[model samples]
Target: MSEQPKTSAAPARLPGGNRRPAGGPPWANAGMPAEKSMTFWPSARRLIHRLRPYRMALLSVVALGVASVGLSVYVPKILGQATDIIFSGVIGRRLPTGSTQEQAVDGLRAAGNDNLADMLARMDVTPGAGVDFTALSTILAWAVVLFVLSSVLMWAQGWILAGVVQRSMYELRAEVEAKLHRLPLPYFDNQPRGELLSRVTNDIDNVAQTLQQTLSQLLTSLLTVIGVIVMMFWISPLLALIALIAVPLSMIVTQQIAKRSQKQFIAQWTHTGTLNAHIEEAFTGHELVKVFGRQKEVEATFAARNAALYDASFGAQFVSGIIMPSMFFIGNLSYVAVAVVGGLRITSGAMSLGDVQAFIQYSRQFTQPLTQVASMANLLQSGVASAERVFELLDAAEQSPEPAAREAAPTRGRVAFEGVDFRYQADTPLIEDLSLVAEPGQTVAIVGPTGAGKTTLVNLIMRFYELDGGRITLDGVDVTELRRDELRSKIGMVLQDAWLFGGTIRENIRYGRPDATEEEIRAAATATYVDRFVHSLPDGYDTVIDSEGGNVSAGEKQLITIARAFLADPALLILDEATSSVDTRTEVLVQQAMAALRTGRTSFVIAHRLSTIRDADLILVMEDGRIVEQGSHSQLLAAGGAYRRLYDAQFTSAAVDLDESGAAAVMAR
Candidate 1:
């Protein structure tokens, strides 16, 4: 059956009419609200919860990070020891031969240079010795070993974190996939397809990247900052204090910039979803757009959405980009302060030259991590924004659950709608107190104008939407008591739109019943006349259908669907405008096949063509959700009511066209 017509004031609430409102882009629908301020912590916490299963791997990464950062922090101190050894040897070579180090210290003290004497006492030196290259070489060697070991541990940490992130993302993607299956039909009707696609593809990818890039680096940076601070204070407290002043300033900078950029990141992803929806719609309807001369309008809308996305992306990047430079400025100031203080301490002999040098290195190490942390703020914000979108999808309301104990479906199809009451919207009544029955082996044809709930009737029989009141039964058993899958397995349906997957023709036909033997497949194909055109092709049944099924004509596609339904051997069959796409000659053949298929099964056929249903056991004429007239075709035509008006209208138009053609031909002759 054709789709119900939509009104300009109200959205479509039934199948075929289940689309976002017209006259604007899908994102402009009232259902899709403006982008709100991101709830970063909640979304981030939920994202982190996805890693609960990887606790052991994450702990291993943490242990490696600690060892690596510890070794890295100590290496500079070891090198500082080597520096002291070299300096002490140079001084010792200038002293008198055989003079004790204690005697030199006393001599310096006697000259009233107490600070220099104290510095000399701190160093391990012999007054008469030359440079201690042996000790220096040992310290340098240890430093190299520590550096290499630290690097190995850091690499191992990164490797573990990468695995954990990927595995977590895999679980997340699986959950999203499963969640999509559970969402109700109405949810999809209100949502844009491309928006959902962006959430599944683009948003998940962004979240994965954020975790892969930031998790390891952020962990190591924070650990390095802690280790460096401890080493700095151990070497010289005064210089440590001088270096610590930059921490607050860096925090202030990060906090302020992140606040401004967080909203922009949210806007960026929201616009991305909207733009994706627009592109998907435009491409899917490209032929229609071109036929209507709306190519320029489509292009204009695309440009506007693209520009919005660009502006949002630019604003987010620009605001977050300020962080690194500001951090560098703060770090440089700390480095200078530490350097000047260390030099003065050395001149006063309050600190050893080696200790001062190690403290200076620690100061740089401290500031570098702070800078890195600041730089990563943008990635964290963007990722959290995307995570929030994914979370929303995962949290959408699901369809009603199945019963724990399911009733067995009936073997024979005897369907009845007893005092059924339903409506797409609470206020808009479509079907009220509707009652009907189709006995076993009977053919029931439903005829209706557009928006007359023809397709909605079949959809209800399939339990696509729940009734507002009353119940439907099959063979005197409530359909709700049976498992949906079990009930649906006994029925076969063919929709108006002939959907085919990208595969060989044989595979598409076998999709209806996977366990059907090859012989049975060919038999069903021949019965539906699909073999007529398929056999003419080079590959015959093996001919491949593209994603869009463009290689096959519409009639061929319809035939394949019919063959699929035929192969099911269903107890109940539903054909919704099944032959509307075929030409007159093909339609006649299809009608014969359908007649054979419906021989002993209860069938419900929804059709607009009145000529197709003249032989049906019963004809139901529906108008505005009510069965205004129903009986055998001859009886209804005899009464000259709704069914007679419809039948007359169709044949009258055909008769006029035929007479006009005849008159024109005679005049030309």
Candidate 2:
């Protein structure tokens, strides 16, 4: 008697106010943002801590990154020197009297570049003199080599960082998967499966993409900015001051735009999940939509969600889109400022023409990183948003801890509920002060109308939902005192909608008891009569079942499920409307197999058809969450109570719904 719902209605609204088709339960925040508020930095810190193990690899990546940026920055200076060599060649003049090599060495010393002066003196060129093409070509060659080395370092850094980011994502995904298993059922009840799937797949993927695309770029950009700033000052302090003015302005502009666009990015991420949730819901329930003729309404819902997604996406993209161009505009402005100022300095002989060119190049290099950061601003924000969602799932409270001193207890088929109280919601009580006991090997039949707490009782027995008060015990020991796995191992459940994963029929059955031998599997299948149809299929037990077991008939699926439960050979069995889907002939076979399986076990049978449980040792009839009648069939019928009325109603309804000829025969009888 598993309490898991066979079908649940779609939530009214997904996150971001994307509504499902109208007319359903209250809107759920399933795939939406967390109700429990969280800040950004805390989630970021958690992810950073997860990435701590690979810090050395990251450090190596940083070293490579810095080396790459340094080479890149140094190349422009070398190119500027090459430009100076070419300019001197075009001028082509001999030194005037008294302008000796000693004076050139003194000038270089004042410029703080004695090494360049030494190299120049070694070249033995008299100033002003004819072109030194050989020396000039050598400087240009060195520039090319430096450029090649810089590119190689950049490539190496990218490669190493890719591995680090991917490995961190792997560990992150594993932790989230493990956390899913540890989270309580109640947590899932309030969450959308689509949203959780998004966290594990899409959201984490966003984080990975951000790391791969942005992390190295961020490091390079920061280093480039600092390196370029230093080079600009070294070229000429006055021109560097002129270029530095834009730094504050660029930061101000970037901060303003990023602050606005970050909100849009958050909305973009939320709406993206909402849209995914809607698509998942619509597809999962597509058959229901067609049956109920809700295609138009479903489309309408989709259109609305798509529109919401588009708005968020457009806003985020448009706002972030401007950041690059805006930063470029500021960069170009600073370039103009440097050109006007450096040109005057070069004319005044306060700076060389080559120095002015390098200063202009340095100004561009400095702003390039700012431009990159602005472009990546939206990506980083989106990643941060996704990280928050993933962290929320990881931070969710896990199932209650087991007692430290507890040991495994023998489950000998005896079960009892002592004054149990439970409710799905705080305001709505489904079961109140319910008490019952099933002795070893007893068959307890619980019959009730839908929502009469019949399934809830089964849920309580399985400890799917914590009881608000009182306690449930197995073999005289409180079930909660035992480990959940240990307790559930003793109970086998078969529901109305038989659940089968995507695997071979034999594999699905083996899933019940992973250690079961082939012989044991065959024996269990034989007992459940599943072997009858199984052998007929071309692949026999090797036949693969689709997700939801759709490849097989419902009755056949149930039989296989029964075979699974039989293989487990649990001491307590729960048959939840097990025969409700089968034809009369198949029902007889299933009932026979169920009887055989329950021979030595305590069984709780929740059935819509009363005739199946006529021979049960005890029958408890419930209404309004309380047992109104308790006795065997004959005893309950003799009492002429609510159970009798229910029995008569079902009997009369079956008679009335018979075919015309059968009705006449019944009337005649």
Candidate 3:
């Protein structure tokens, strides 16, 4: 029977629909609230908790940020004071020559500074000077020093925060990796590899970038806003009230735009994953596409996905782009309003010119934080969206729980399936009330037509899929009672699609038994006839293979995987169409190697070729998930049942092909 791919659970959606929405960009759904409202605080709380290990470093960043903003806010006030001193010197010029000196001396004497008063009495004074240039220079020098100090603090904070962000991301990546291992195989089977890749790579990177680039600024901007607000009130409460009006207007605009843009960003990443999936699928099946003449269709599909991605990306970015410009407009309006009001108060003699100037600076600073907050709104939303995607993967259903203790001893390969009932979906039953057994040191060959549940039997034995009802036992112990690791370690599998990583041939062979010695590795290779080709390569056993095993032929790659299983020396072996891809000569050699490997071990062989399993201790024929026949090859052939029909069909087809070829040759002659 042809093997059917196992059905798995419904795939998880990553925020948006699997593809772009049918209408247009996400904003096309504007005026309607999102299906699920996303607020920043929840994601923020989770992120903070994830970074709790680095809280001390975060606190240091906050402290440095406060110090930096404090210096910045104070500098403007100091500059305003210096301006007032200069203005006073320029405007009040009458008593500067001699009378001013007498007044200064009298004031010093009254304040009990007799020594300073005596010194002032002796120095000659100029009649009139515009300003005290020395004092102004000192104040400017102090301002420059504060600016440098603030800059240094800002740099230090960023340097430390980088470490914090990197370490947090490292932990997050590790957690995702661990989660992948624990997740049930169905999770992988159902989900697209490209989507999963995006979550692990793109989504995590988004979070990292946001934390690194925006985190420090977010803290500093907030402190600047608060400090500036207090300073504005100190300068003039009436003007401070006027500047405060811009805050709500900026927030309202930011919220309305953000609501729409957040949906677009989610759509953007979703389509990005879809686009990636298409690219991956096309490349993986490029040969098939060429043979089937589907290149044009593939290109058209890719163009459609690409266009969807561009639309979503453009919508998100364009909407977010408006925020900064809108903020600037509002900020300018507020700045002008404050300047006009402050100038009026200055002219009325209620506020000094210096005070008016300081208030204007404070007003500018206030608007700056509001603008920054608006800018960060989109970035934070993207980060939070990415975070939610990651967390969803981490929260997927894991594999069945392990037993608290291993109640069964190591398996001796006496496998039994009793009263087995299974199904992929509730309404579709695949295996119904089945039973079977394989004794130790026996080779059981399973043959069936396509969709006959041949591979599903092996899957059940390997515990890849849990049976809905019934128990499978190994060595007279329930397999479920055995620890999963303990159960899997004792069985070795060689699949139809041979996989080799980007490593030396020797390393791939030693994958199962990592500590296998060089001699054993070579022995396994030699036994599997892999060494024949290995010696032809430039580096023999050390020849490096590409990730796709492009450096070796398919037959050679299969031999290497067989060698890997041989090195493992599992107590039970599973070969599902193992020799299906090999040439006739290689198949004979592989059969020889498999015969040796099967000695004294129980094995399950799922194959269509009747010739390969002719010497099996038992042959079982399955159809529609039921065992229709079971016997030795000779006995099954003698019975003239399902096994006989299958054997007859294969050989008959081969004989007809041979006769037709000979007839064609005769006719040509």
Candidate number with greatest TM-score: 1
Instruction: Give the alpha-carbon lDDT of every model.
Output: 0.86, 0.81, 0.83
Q: Return the number of clashes found in candidate 1.
A: 0
TM-scores of the candidates in the order shown: 0.92, 0.90, 0.90
> Each model's number of backbone clashes?
0, 6, 6
Give the candidate number with the greatest lDDT: 1
Residue range 1-669, candidate 1, lDDT tens digits: 576422222343332335444423324552132233447788889899999899999999999999999999999999888878888998898878888888998999999988788888877888879878888888999999999999999999999999999989998999999999877666666577898899999999999999999999899899999999899888888888889899988898899999899988988998899898999989998899999999999999989989989999999999999999999999999988988988878767787788888888888889888888888889999999999988888877777787666645447889999988877765678888889999999999999788788888888888877788889998887878776788789899998999999999999999999999999999999999998899898899999998678899988999999999999999999999999889999998889999999999999999999888889998888898888999999999999999888888898868988999999999999
Which runs of model 1 end up more than 4 angstroms from their true locations? 4-27, 30-38, 94-118, 405-409, 654-669
Residue pairs that clash (backbone atoms under 3 angstroms), model 1: none
Q: 313-382, model 2: which lDDT tens digit per residue?
A: 8998898788889889988998998999887665554666677788888998988898999899888877
Among all windows of ten consecutive residues in candidate 2, which has the lowest summed lDDT?
Answer: 2-11
Superior candidate under lDDT, 2 versus 3: 3
Alpha carbon lDDT at 531, candidate 2: 94
